[model samples]
Target: MTNEELQTLVKTISIDVFKKPFLHQAKHNPRLRTTGGRYMLADHTIEINPLVFKVHGMDELVGVIKHELCHYHLHLEGKGYRHRDEDFRKLLNETSSPRFCKPLAAQNKKSTSFYIYECESCKLKYKRKRRVNVQKYRCGKCAGAISIQINK
Candidate 1:
């Protein structure tokens, strides 16, 4: 959705869910990375990661909005607004807002490479970028046998 649409949606959600109107602006912020949305403490505005809607759809978008709204309303009322606050936690439960925004599918789409190994005797863990010969390798700490598991 466009920034205008996002603004309208945030306003609507603020009223419908919080019983409080959202006076500040809401917009899609391209610079937002892993976060689904952010509530600006300075301006009381909301910035949403556009990839939220693009990768997860409307439900996820609404979830992000709701999460940010918790911050918005609590901060405005001078109550506990941060993620760790009791008031914020209560409001989140009351409004059914997600504790944390869901990770965007786009983030999961990035290429990943890793090799996991566990020593047979000592159960020590190791991660490496390249594959290693299990028979030739041993745990450094205990000199236990090593095995490899590739993850991508």
Candidate 2:
């Protein structure tokens, strides 16, 4: 959704669920990778990861907004706003907001490069995250000379 839509959604959810107004801005932040949404302590703004709606749909997006609203309302009222705080926990329970969001699908993929080492004699294979020195290291199974295959 566009920034204007996100802002309106946040405002609506804030008033409907929390009985409080969201005066600050709410927008989708492309830079947010791991989190569904975040409440900025300094600016009082709410930033939602765009992938929430694109990947998980509207229900998940509303859950994320509810979670962030808990933080926004509690912080503004000068109550405990951290995740571990009693007031925060109570507010979450009262509002029926999710304590954590489901992980994004794109985040669960393996993207790192790795190396495969094989024994020349025994044909045993091993995987290593970093490069192995084939000239010095021998296979553990047969003490045979090693060969390397790069996997990206």
Candidate 3:
């Protein structure tokens, strides 16, 4: 979608969900890598990953918009807007917004250079040169089950 479309969607979601208007810009940012979306504290803008709509479709895109709107509305009103803040948490719960944006599929398209391992318990991402034995060797960080990360 175009930037204008994103702005309209963000504004609509802000009003419908939070009962507040989003006065700032909402545009697709090509630079975003891992995160689905981000709210800018400095400019009061919301940068959404374009790959979200292209890859995941509208339902997932709406969820991300809701998540970012929580930050945008709360921060503007001088309430607790940070992810860890009580007000932010309460608003997120109230609006049924996801605690965090879903990981973009674009981010999972890993290259074939190195093998990646993730700890099941701690969710710590690790990259290694050698193949890891998941059964015999546990995670170095949490002593949890180690599994290879397969791109999906």
- The top-ranked prediction according to TM-score is 2
Better of 2 and 3 by TM-score: 2
Over 15-36, each residue of candidate 3 has an lDDT whose tens digit, in order, gives: 8887888888999998998888
Which candidate, 1 or 3, has the higher lDDT? 1
What digit string (tens of lDDT, one per residue) describes model 1 on residues 9-42?
9999988998999999999898888799899999
Worst 10 residues of 1 by lDDT: 103-112
Global fold similarity of model 1 (TM-score)? 0.70
| Candidate 1 overall lDDT versus native | 0.88
| Top candidate (lDDT) | 2
Which ranges of candidate 3 are over 4 A from the true structure? 106-152
Q: Estimate each model's TM-score.
A: 0.70, 0.73, 0.69
Against the correct fold, how does model 2 do in TM-score?
Answer: 0.73
Per-residue alpha-carbon lDDT of model 2 for 1-152, expressed as tens digits? 99999999999999999988999999989998888999999999999999999989999999999999999999999999999999999999999999998887645657676888888899998999888778889989889999985465
Worst 10-residue stretch by lDDT in candidate 3?
A: 103-112
In model 3, which residue pairs have backbone atoms overlapping below 3 Å? none
